[model samples]
Target: MLNAFRARFWDLALGSAMTVLFALSGTAVALPLAVAQLLPLFWRRRFPAAALLIVGSATAAHTVLGMARAIGFFPATIALYTAATHGSPRVKWVLCPAVGVAMAAASAVRHGPVEGLLMAIVTVTVAWLAGMERSEHLRQRMERAAAEDRERLARRVHDSLARTVTVMLLQTEALRATTPLDSAAEQRIDTVLGAGRSALAEVREALAAAGSGPALGPRLEMLRGAGLRISGHPPARLPAPLQDITDRLITEAATNALRHDGPGTLLTITTVPGDGTLTVRLTTEPGGSASGSQRAGGGFGLVSLTADIHGYGGELTFGSRHPAGWQLEATFPALVPGHD
Candidate 1:
């Protein structure tokens, strides 16, 4: 909304300046034509092709009517640049050249063929090329930023969670060696050891994949073995960062559920893929009395997860479900940042 307001404000200011310039130049008769040539620029970024067509048409009319050439040329060139920069892929390449040619023909009416062609080449063609270059530069910069973010996330997971899991694995090993226990208790400890080992391996894989590894299938199987009543199938081949976030979200949410709601908690995980977006939902019902209480607002894990999700232009929401349960849902764009 703020961006739209600023664009409109810029267009208004440009239009006003052009109108004033015409009025002061003793071409007051062309003020109306100038307004027509410049008004469509207000929507130039939002509706680039349509805006370019309207602005180009009005500028052509303005030139043919013997109006101030500056008034028509300036806004037309701006529209051409915008069309090249932000227009839909289906129309951008086609519309820009067509509009450039039309505007050049109009210029010829006043400036003659040779000068008009030079003006179009120098202004319109240059503007289009500049816009394309700017667009490509912005895309490369955004991709680099996204890659950096993924690397940072991978480092955090390696430094924090991986170390913690290592400690847990060592502790479980020491307990089994030093303490006497019945067969059943030994089996439970063995289960913990297996889970810790699996987690450590998964963490290593995540680091190797730059936070985008970890097969969801095996993780879900492990969770099921841990007695979580799981449902829903995982989507295959999610984008790198998205798959990473999804894995982390599920791990964090399930850990909280098992800690707070205890073993045998019914967990329903669903993934819904939509037009350029993916939504994941996890719902957990308390299996019994609380094993532990979570800190207010779901503790640091959820807080951190929320920040990560938002960083990817996604949303993460969680709250208590009615009739005693917890729910978490995340929705994000399916594509990586700067990707098509």
Candidate 2:
């Protein structure tokens, strides 16, 4: 109620002020007509088309009566702008021409036909241009809002679902190690762990789709307590698009080590500067000697890592170790690798 009163007050205050100025300037002689044309402006946004129709009809009537003052143009100009900003584009197109014709008819009745038509055309063009500018500003504001929303959702995913998945993987490992189970039970636990790891990967991809932000490496530090050994240089700043990708790759690799390599797996992660390349290697090995079947548990993470590396003209490779485990290596082109 207060807001409605404030809006109505502002419209009346400004409308009355314009009317008085025009009256003094000999542009408007009547107060009632000018007020009628402008009073509806208070509701312009709430009902743009209806407000415009009311103002436009009043304007047409005032012009026919030869009491049309230059000040009277203010209300119509504002009404058209409100409609353009709030109404659909089709409405903008229709109102512009209609307002122009009304102005021309009024001008023809009061002044000579040629002079009135010219003045109407100029006034209508100015209103149209002002409306277009308002619409563009509104569009830009909406886009910024949508982008902010996506970033908010991304942060929530990281804080909630992603962390939960990590906890599940860690607990699964602890359960596997402490309780001796038959082969069938062990296999079931492995399946659940694998699914949890895959969910983490999907969350990482969601972060990418949400848009870039501050380096995620800092955030990934929470996983240190989740049962995976993380050893590397403190995450470094990389090239524009590469920073987020590198952070995600590191997080995903560490997660795969903990989840898929089974209980008591050792992970060795190394990252450092090389000649024109940023080198990253993650090697995972089971605690005990691996048989032929155990050696192939590298998981599906390497496929995405390979594709992302290739996008930046980098090379990615993975191979089974001689004794046990799997080693995945990727080198990204960097003009200055070690430099922050």
Clashes per model (N, Cα, C within 3 A): 0, 0
Model 1 worst lDDT window (10 residues): 331-340
Model 1 off-target regions past 4 Å?
Answer: 1-12, 26-31, 211-340
Q: How accurate locally, in lDDT, is each candidate?
A: 0.73, 0.67
Each prediction's TM-score against the native? 0.62, 0.54
Question: On residues 33-101, what C-alpha lDDT tens digit does candidate 1 reach at each position?
Answer: 676676787766656678888888877777777766654577888887766665544445777888878
> What is model 1's C-alpha RMSD?
8.3
What value does the lDDT take at residue 254 in candidate 1? Answer: 77
After superposition on all C-alphas, the RMSD of every candidate to the true structure, in Å, is 8.3, 20.9
